[model samples]
Target: MRTLLSNIKVQVNPKIYIKDPETSVLGRKIIQESIILIDEIGFDSFTFKKLGDRIGSNESSVYRYFENKHKLLVYLSSWYWSWMEYRIVFATANIADPSEKLRKAITLVTEKIEDDATTDYIDESVLNRIIIAEFTKTFLTKEVDLENKEGFFLIYKRVVNRIVDIITEISPDFPFPKSFASGIVEGSLHQHFIKDHFKTITDCNDDVSPTDFYLHLATFITKQP
Candidate 1:
């Protein structure tokens, strides 16, 4: 599975960038180093100038691939979702039970992300940190509606829809599969964030595993009401 995934290229939305970052060595450096820098500092403080300094390139070179940091963020977020969808497909393949499939999906979303060597350029663990820490900024802006119309959120929507399909298969009468899917994904991220930064706000302590909490939520939500 790792070998198969290594050969796969997760495509980002073309509209999010000025040039395809994966096509050039310098462009890929911008992406690889930006993830590291953003994780080290944050999205608000990160800039193409800082990125150029880190990658030993000029600011204009980075700008060639991305118009600005926001577009780069959207590109990174889209890439992460695309990679996650790939993982879900590979992990749940050949599974005959919807309940088991749902469980696997929940675990995949909630569990701690380890570094995936399959993707040599982009570090999955660091990218996961960025997604958890700063991904909402990609769409929470005033331009989100316009971007939505442009299909900027397609990969994320596709991931949620994929899980929703499994959910509806498990409980055909489920009325809020989409809500449940989105909630589980976003909720898992929230719980992790809370656990890391604001422990008082959530019950996600050392004894209470996020995987268990999310699996319980999925079971309860899918049960006949």
Candidate 2:
């Protein structure tokens, strides 16, 4: 699976960038450095000038690919989810049981991520950190509705929809698969965050993980054995 996925491109929304970062060496370098920089100093403190210094490229060069940091973030988030969508599809492809399929999908979303060696430019492990820490900022803006209409979050919505489909398959009578799916995806990030920062609040830790909690919820809510 890793070998097959290595050849696949994690496509992002073209609207998210002026030039596709995956298209050129310089563009890829911008993405590679930006992920490291954002994870190090945080998204709020991240800037194109700082990125330029890190990549040894002019500030305007960064702008050629991305109009602003917000779009760049959206691009990164889209790429991450697109990669995840591919993974979920591959992981759940041959399972005969909906329960097991849902478990795999849930684990994919909720567990600690590892970097994929396939995409030499982007780091999934650090990108997961950025997603966990800063993904919400992408849609917390006034233009979110407009962006949504423009399909800036299509891949994210699709990933959640896959979970929703799996949940619905497990229990056709389930009352709120969409809500449950969105909650699991978003809430897992919250749990992981608090598990690191506010350890007193979340049960996720070294022994327990966000995946275990959500998988339990899936069984309990779906009444699956």
Candidate 1 segments exceeding 4 Å error: none
- Whole-model lDDT per candidate: 0.89, 0.93
The clash count for each model shown is 0, 0
Candidate 2 lDDT, tens digit per residue, 23-136? 899999999999999999999999999999999889999999999999999999999999999999999999989989999999999999998988888889999999999999
Error in Å for residue 196 of model 1: 0.8
Q: State the lDDT of candidate 1 residue by residue for 156-178, as single tens digits.
A: 99888889999988888888899
What TM-score fits each model? 0.97, 0.98
Candidate 1, residue 184: how far the Cα is off, in Å: 0.4
Q: Candidate 2: where are CA atoms >4 Å away?
A: none
Specify the highest-lDDT model's number: 2
